[model samples]
Target: MDSSGAGAGAASPNPKCCVSLSAFYNNTIVPCPNCSCNCKGLPGAKCHSEENAGSMLQMPHDPLQEPEDLVRCTDHMCPIRVHWHVKQNYKAYWRVKITVTNLNMVRNYSDWSLVVQHPNLQSVQQIFSFNFQPLKIHGFLNDTGMFWGVRYYNEILMQSGVDGNVQTEMLLSKNTSLFTLHEGWAFPRKISFNGDHCVMPPPDDYPRVPNSSTASKLSLPVLVFISLLPIIIFVGPSHFLDYL
Candidate 1:
């Protein structure tokens, strides 16, 4: 198992650059007031800044003065925060299970998505399906297969209730797979959980061409031509003089 703190732990400061699960899950998406794009002031606009404080950019799909379904967190007992844990004794091709709790008093989530990412591997990206419902106790349930070796962290994105007020989310998972969790996560912004869509961080690395594709393109003649480079370098000038 790869340690979550190794190659996957590297960090970059670009907001567009993806980050690990721990860093990705810890932040919130607030509205960006400086964004001038005319796309209904949604949170995912490309030009939002994190430096300014208390400035709100509305949800990309939400209207400015529309009625919002407001729910208060009376669960002083549970508190308003994201919580999650993974069992150590787990195994499979991808056997990772995580749970998130929405400790709000009387609210259920309308839409939610689970973000699990790793830095080293590409085939293991998994975003669990979201079912629209405000979680009363343990919040909504979402589980993903353990696809790769290890994961660094996990992120839960939420849009709550009928009006999509949003709720506290959590992060959990092995540190290795969690490395690039923040690749596409939006921060310092509030979001409405819409069943129709979920925000995903772009790939930290591009996909590689398959070995079979490369093999099919190269043949015996091509191999011989490439192999002659070294011999040509040693005997080149003599052959060039003869040609001249």
Candidate 2:
């Protein structure tokens, strides 16, 4: 084997428009950037309109057909997208929903996989409509997970159309002492599709759990205590203790 290596060409960076993360939290949905991909400029690029997308999806996919990028027409112009949503919060648990959409009209994936990272992924108690395995990267405190569809069900992600998406929801037990919803802490830190890293929205754009909401929670209890103070004083300590 020759020790001298061939000349390496200039590095070609990853495209910013191939895929994006569309996140929804609380009452806000963070959308992908407009016109992120120059699909129109690409030679032989094709896009299906919203009205035709549903009809095209009804057709059976051809397994032996040649691969091509057939994306649906959207503001982002990407061939695929990933969505993360914070569905609900409970006293001891929180819920999340992840949806993966294939905008390509001609591409269907088999044995697809997703890689996710977040602080509380190890605390996930249950997952619906998907399979999950923890990735033990940091000793016993695994913060990463690999997810895939249930076989014979959503294992094959259909091409772009009305039902060209797969979805799953999960519940994670919260450690009250360490859990927080603020600063996008409730959302996934990173996600990848089929080994390709997805483009994430900037931190400043993430849906925030504002301080006003937390203050509102505290206000109610303080109001109740204030209202009862006069009664306690009027009844005296002895009467108040007996009433309790």
**Model 2 regions lying over 4 Å from their true place:** 1-25, 35-46, 52-65, 138-141, 213-244
For each candidate, what TM-score against the reference? Answer: 0.22, 0.72
Q: Candidate 1's C-alpha lDDT?
A: 0.27
| Number of backbone clashes in candidate 2 | 1
Winning model by TM-score: 2
The candidate that wins on lDDT is 2
> What TM-score number comes out for model 1?
0.22
True-structure Cα RMSD, model 1:
17.1
Candidate 1 per-residue C-alpha lDDT over 151-217 given as tens digits, one digit per residue, 9 for 90 to 100: 2222222223233222222222334543332333212112111111122223332122233456578
